[model samples]
Target: MAARHSRKLLRPLLYTSAAAAAGAGVLYISYRPRNIPGLEAPAVPPPGYREGKLVPPSFPSIKSRLEQIQDLKRSNDEEEYDLLIIGGGATGAGIALDAATRGLKVAVVERDDFSSGTSSKSTKLVHGGVRYLEKAVWELDYNQ
Candidate 1:
């Protein structure tokens, strides 16, 4: 008898919860920003918008870039690289950048896109480091 009464109570509670959820969803959809007036994407081209080229031509053209890749591949097979970094994440990219700055012929090859691992994922907090620092200061822990 008590189980039956409990279930009867649960059914109404579930229905009301579901109705509230649906109403919240409708509210969110109706009240959300369409666009900020000034921030709306320009209909006509904005200043300095190029027609044909996206970036400046002083940067290597597509053909030159392809040729450079071919040449690099050929040379890499024949000649040993000064620094051959395997990944494209923070550590690998940093090492490659450091080596290149030091006048080394650095090559970084990754199975996935750049920063596809740790760098892409969220730490899931704002001011996390600052909070940590505040806690450490409060606790008087220097090692942290």
Candidate 2:
């Protein structure tokens, strides 16, 4: 009877150990750094970021909303943007960044605050659309 009781406890312990091992394996797989193609070198820390903490940069006096709007208008009238993004959400912001990085003048105009639109309601998963994949297969379009 004692042996059977011990066996029951051992079975649960064995199951718990297996679960812990599985969880650890998943964590290792998820967090393990892999070498990316174009990012061979280590990333440089952003400005105002130092030693595991962010050192906020000193800025000029904060402008009022009206002043900011006037400044934006002046800049918009003076400079021509190669790409003008309608939204300031994730997709628009990403496009603007890419364009600016490629030496293009990019302007993003948002009606609401950045990411206040559809970008805010994200699952946080980077995934390709299955519909697009299906379409690609059907049309034999490798670029899709």
TM-score, one value per model: 0.35, 0.40
Which pairs of residues collide in candidate 1? Answer: none
Clashes of each: 0, 0
Candidate 1 lDDT score relative to the true structure: 0.70
Q: Give per-residue CA lDDT, model 1, range 8-120, as digits (tens).
A: 99999999999999999999999997754446444444435367656432433344445646766788455878987887677777667657665578877777766787666
Off by over 4 Å in 2: 1-68, 76-78, 119-144
Q: Each model's C-alpha lDDT?
A: 0.70, 0.71
Model 1's TM-score against the true structure: 0.35
Residue 101 shift from truth in candidate 2, angstroms? 0.9
Candidate 1, residue 54: the lDDT equals 65
